[model samples]
Target: IFFVSIKLTVPLAYFYILLILVRELCEKFPGSLYIPIQTYLPYLASVVSTMQKSSTFVEVWAIIEALFYICLRLHIQWLQYKDPLEASLSSAPMLELWERRQLWERIMEIETDDPVSFVTGWFFDQDLQHITRYDVLDFVAWSMFEGRNQEHLTGDELGQLHDFVDELEWKISEHLNRSDSLIPEKNTDKNEVGDNRKDNQETPITSEFTQEKNDLDLSDGISSPRRDQGDRPRNQFRFPENVDDDSPDFFTNLYENYHNWYEQTKDRLENSDFHPVQGIRNYMAEKRQQIVEKEKNAMATASNLAENAYNRLVSPGSNMDKQLMALSHATQSQLMDAWNSMVEMKERLETAKFVSSKRKVLQQQLRGYRHLLDSARAMSSAIPSNQMADLMRKITQCNEAIERVEWSARDAFVKATGYARKNILQRTEPQRYAKYSHDPLLGISTYPLMFHLLILGVTDGGLRVILRRRGFERRTMGPIAYYFHPGSSDHTEDENEELNDEDREMTPIVFCHGIGIGLLFYLPLIDEMLRLGRPIFLPEIPYVTGFRPWQSP
Candidate 1:
């Protein structure tokens, strides 16, 4: 009898568990699980009936279990097909300005032969959707042309590119607007459902009925915004007119207004006789005066605290240590304020558009900060021994801050006076072999050549193993991989031995591979150079070696 009771309870327990799981799935997916539930309701009813009647209960239970498993599998597959990007957008009213800027930067960094395919692959990898390949390609092309000042392009081409960009921007705006409209409705519905569930929890039967009604309403595309509004209190604080609190659209508009204001300010400063460098100097002078006042106040406070501590030593419950700690904190705070002021002055000097004379003035201001730092350090010795650790830390920090300011000032002066030289040996033109001028159909015609390349690659791997055995060391520097073999002379026994008159100078050979299958074809040349008793260096240019075609050399 005990075994029979346990057997009966197990099936009922499973039925209840399945019901709970289905309810959770419905809540999680919202409007997505309606069709699956409708199709399986009959099977669920039969299973419940069989459990009650005890006739063919095992067979019916197995069948229902199989159907549930199948439904779950289908649901998972459906979830995989859903566009996560669209889902995220639906949850939010609009993208933040920073997020949009980051997205634009990522799009600009795409350096590929096929922008469309490259962007498409990225979207699929990132689980994004709603952005088409053509739109991405158009944006990339327009950005590239604009960066180059539309060089080598006709006027018609430029006009067409501009039109493409305008259309793409319009489409994005429309999509965002649509999201803004739909998200509020969804949020209201969710709030109403939550409130309804809370109210129904007192009676299980009523809760079940309410759950069914909510699911039905969701499937029929209905919401209760009026009910939600009626539930809200009238005395709640509201946002100001023409303002959207924490909304991206509002922030973007604010940013544009700020930018326009900055431009006007810059233009006014440029047109006026007032020099920005002079203003910076005046600001620095005021800050220095404030720092001097703070130092004097700190010294007075410390001296007064010490005298008070001496007087309180004779009293009960004096708390002299606490008073000393407070004084130390106050002094540290003053030092921190001074350091912050110096940092701000440095930033202002760097940002000011100044000539050589103005730069010299900024340098003088920086030197003043350094002198202040020296004085602060000298004054730190007066701090109590117990508090010396924290004071010393603050002094070190101030020293670092002043050093940074001096370095930035010098860098700014160099930039203003054109003292820094640029690298002249860097390549300016694109490589001929790197150009993607060949027809894509050539890939199909050259299909058989891939086998030959694969064989060469395998042979190259084997040759590398042999080179490793022959005392050659392979290493990587950034993106370039090279093989180095210190020649026989490097391992000579006598360090101070002079060369004989008959011996000539031996120089190492540095060989770089071209646009082909890497160093596999140059083994013979390497061998010949190695026989001359000189070191051999072979740097592998993977980007031009046909294997790493996606990379830029």
Candidate 2:
């Protein structure tokens, strides 16, 4: 009995001491329990039953040893089941609206000399939305023209530009055709209504027609032709009411003209005899002369205004203060008129087709108005201090507005020429795995190898089983495998009933292991965390697991 007791009691006492030590440590840490006390209840009951039945020390020790091995086996099974790396693959999340906007902003910020190649490479094998694709196409198209001379471009570069423009035009044409197809359906419905109420709606129809005509005249800056009532068609189709009557037809004509111009430019590029550069230089010289003449006229007007102000100031029986005020008011009025003209020019530029000649003319007119405003500003400096301050403030505001208009005009032109429809029709499969070279076991520690061979497998298997029992589901997203538990829903009813307000409000924890022994090493910590009743996400990083150096996802 003494020999048997020594053999059984020593191991049993050691196990009890270890358990006590663990309990004490858990108490000290305040919420960390490696294994809950309930886990030992079966062992405790068996020991009590053996002692009560007067069982021999050898039998008692055999029973204790068997129970210990059984517990170890259960742990190994749990580890295998709960392993995140073993999870199945899931689909990647779609990009949100704000994320796409941010992506576009970042793409626009990228500056490169070869924008076409850069854009194509960036978008290759990637799915993009229609508007986003168009925005990119427009940016590339405008970039080709920006600060680039047609004569200087190589054959390949010119061809590329031409091809991109053709694509852009095709996209625009497709959109217009789609819009046209929808138009007749809407018009037919309107025609049916008009036919049914012909007599009763005549007065209203006539009034609506007159209103539409007035609107077209005001917006298009062209008067509608007068037609006799007898000449009107019985089934006249009306377009959908829009701010710009030009709409699809105007854009279609503009693109067509641009295409012709592009063909002519391409021909010029190919021909050595025709010097388009020389013609462009001559045109620029003529514009410069016109600008000089306009500047002279502005100077003359300023001189005349000064002379009139001087005459008023020196004339007998004339109030000096009143004349100065009048001069200031006149200068302010001229500045206001110049600002209004700039605003009108800006509006025209925005609405006008992206024709080079029309853009240059409007830009020239804008410069002339700006010069006039500057001249008016210079004249106003001689006025009273208070009036000068007001004038300067107004001038600043006018300058800012003009700058914004110029930016808007540039953006509009780019959008008109550069944009194209979506190029990607279908998305390709996402990359799932990465290739890595194998490393030899020259410097690797022998202890880790031994531990993994002898101990790690069983522990990992047990951890997996434990996790599965706790209702954690495994899935793979892209290259990473992960385990997820839905917290409250996964928990038993008793556990949910036991949860406090704080536990209910606790945010989900994302637990990722470092470059060590993988997640199996963190089982104790994870087990403690599970008690909080919060959802957990565990993504497996294979490269850092130390088990496999070659195979990685």
Candidate 3:
């Protein structure tokens, strides 16, 4: 009873498992896979059941199972066609049928005597078994379109291959006929349906769907050929014949029209003037240069004042009075120069702002031409006529030339208007003056003032601090380096004790900044050094200073 129950339960379990597999497969795969699995699954089950019986037919069932498995494996691998989106096909069903044909041709290359031998031989080929079905079809396409070498194949192999090809073709045709009812047609007759019939009666249809050619309008002969016409052979080019007068050939006419268009474009670019905004910018730049020069002189005087004061402290009876007096006189002169430069820069900056309207119009025109040129270049590849190649080359040359002139004018206007300078001011200044403001002065719409210099004073670390007000009391000008001394304030005793014997000796760091950079940006670095209990000095830069005098242009 136990053995009889076991036999019955095993067969029942196998049936249940097979049914579950079919259900899952139906849900997971499209018809591409579902069709074959649905057709062969019942046969597979019967063979398995036959092999379980201890009869003489069990060995025969096993042989049949091996052959079915091999055929099924080969069929599954080759039937997995590429997507419709990839192939750019209107119908996926048509693509599946086409892939079926491709697989049939590939299977025909075997030289074996029987179908089982052929299947085994064909399946074991190193080059053909792996990779995608689409790739296999592509290889076949290359051999068909280009020449293929079949010298290695024997005469008997060729005969077998052709015979297999005939049989496979017949089988594929039969499968396609079977699947025909399942695959939807590319065009469905809407008039045969319910609401679609009423809609079709009221609305016009496309030429492809129209039944009556006599009632159709013939206003336009035909729409332009497909955009891929350029990919066809050179012999496919078609142009309407001109038989009236002795006009030039199609290509000659194209060349002449393009040449005239190019000349006109170049002429328009050449005719345009250098806008007046450039002059205003140049004037502003000149004034700014003067201010920068004056600031340099002032920096020199400040440095000299510090040096003179330091000399006096170091040497008691030195002839430092005369040197101090000369430095003071130079400092006053430099300050006056800076003041004059600032006033002139302000006036020129205002003048440069007036030509904003003219600049806008010029920019619009330049952009339009650039966009037109780009459109022309984009259309070049889609143009079917090979004769247009020469014309396109000429058009490209003309476009480049116009671009060069337009860009040069643009650059000049930018430089004259001090656009880059204003951008720098926006980034470096505080958020309060970050908005558009007409004012062009320190801590406002321009480079900020170095307030650190005003609060700076001498320390016990032998630093020579130059007071700007005191330096102006005399007249001379020079450069100055402000020094910071660690262990000079209330924390000095504790800092000194904390320092190791090796770190007790301090190496002074001279803080040098580049052009257009200010001391405020380096405050973080200064703070870090102070935390490390090390001494640092900052030198004043001239060109970056907020004040200056106007120079003679």
Candidate 4:
């Protein structure tokens, strides 16, 4: 019945609009009539009836609607694609859980209906393949535990269920790995471009690196390098002879130990021969020892009294000179090591775009290393000795190179994550992508003209007024916080009479906006008054309101 009505109504509607256009054209120029649509009306009617009976018109309407939506989607994509920065910034990472609520609900429903089918079919579905692999593992684990509760299930059935779950977990991992590998390599290129563009703009880093003591002369603010030269009263600092050669190499050892421990722990967990608590405690202790030793060695390398004393004595210079040079060299070597560490960390961060929090940590670490590098350079320049100072400057240069690498790594991570998120959303839920991509364009295009009255007022010299009741400390002020504009809504008669009076009769309104926000805070109210052609008065307050620097009380 629905199809029959659609078939009948659509053709008649199209014909009705065509006849109206034809009538208007004929009336405007009687002699210009060409096709003579009136003569073919009966034939058109017969064709329409035939199409209705066969329901062929339904397909025609469908095709037309498809074309219309296609054009709409294209326009939306063009608007979003034209502004790439906006698109990247607006990429949603948790879109699957939030905006794709319907899809999640459907998955849960399917899982409830047949847990086994859900577990097996989930990995096969491409749209859902990018979802967190652990989430799938959890679901499979739950399904297995529930199956174990069924009294009707035999030992063979339970064993098969465990086997199926293991296979499903393996497949899910494979799918996630494939998805991660598919993340485009453009992130690295973007990082390079960002580094190059920010080279000149990285003044903060360069200045920080070359920063010096400013207390040499307060009156002239002139830097006196020699004034602080004799300030080093002791030769207490020293550098290890092989400071530059030592590489810590902690991550490699950590990874190896972790992998071996993980495999052994997995076997132990599955065997369940020993008590669970004691076995878990033993596994944890082994892991803790691995990490604790690595950290202890790293800290010892940073400061060792015996090693520093040996390096200083071997130099055989004036005690102070030898100590200064050794200290400079040690600082330089530490800066270089930090630089190398940051580069490696950034690369790892870029390659692993699955966790956003990891990227944030990498960024923070990069910033800290960069700051240390700059401080080394600044402190080097402040040293009076040329040789020691030169070493410090070299350290600064090494840090700058590391900074570039760090920036690239961060850029790569951000870009990769954004790319992955977009692809995942686009594949799993196209409507969500279309909505997110096009909604901004729609808002920009339609916002100003959404209400035709605003458009009409622009040319008509009419102002739009808005009346709002404001709350302050639980008390309400009605009509006091009002927007007055041309053609705006009417207010009380008393207010209108005063507004019309040649001589101002009403008391001037004094707006007391709370907080450090000064006159600029009341700009909206000021604008309304300007529109109404009224005078504005601004009173100066000592430290609270007008012309006052912001200060915390």
Which candidate's lDDT is highest?
2
The order by descending lDDT is: 2, 1, 4, 3
**What are the per-residue Cα lDDT tens digits for candidate 2 across 446-535?**
122223344456655675787788788878976678889876645777977887877778689999899876777887888877777788
Error of 3 at 174 (Å): 38
Cα deviation of 442, candidate 2, in Å: 15
- lDDT by candidate, in order shown: 0.46, 0.47, 0.39, 0.40
lDDT of 1 by residue, 1-553 (tens): 8445533543554565566556556557746774465576767544444444443555455455545445544544554554332333232333223444455445534422233344335345321133433434333443443211122123444454444343333333223323323333244576775564445332322221112222212122212232223222111111112211111122223333444565577689988856565676687789989989998888787978866876767344457667777889998799778767767645544344332234345456545544543453346344333233333334444444534444444455455445763521122221111112111212311111233356556856776897898779998986667999977754244432554433335567889888777787777888777665567888877646653432322
Q: Candidate 4, after superposition: displacement of residue 427 in Å?
A: 16
Off by over 4 Å in 3: 1-53, 82-216, 222-292, 300-553
List all candidate RMSDs to the true structure: 34.4, 29.1, 47.4, 34.4
Residue-level lDDT tens digits of model 3 in 223-245: 21221122211111111222321
Candidate closer to the true structure by lDDT (higher is better), 1 or 3: 1
Model 4 compared with the native: what TM-score? 0.18
- Model 1 Cα displacement at 465 (Å)? 1.0
lDDT value for model 2:
0.47
Better of 1 and 4 by TM-score: 1
Give stretches of model 2 more than 4 Å off: 1-94, 97-459, 465-510, 537-539
What TM-score would each prediction reach against the true structure?
A: 0.20, 0.20, 0.15, 0.18
Could you tell me which 10 consecutive residues in candidate 3 have the lowest summed lDDT? 429-438
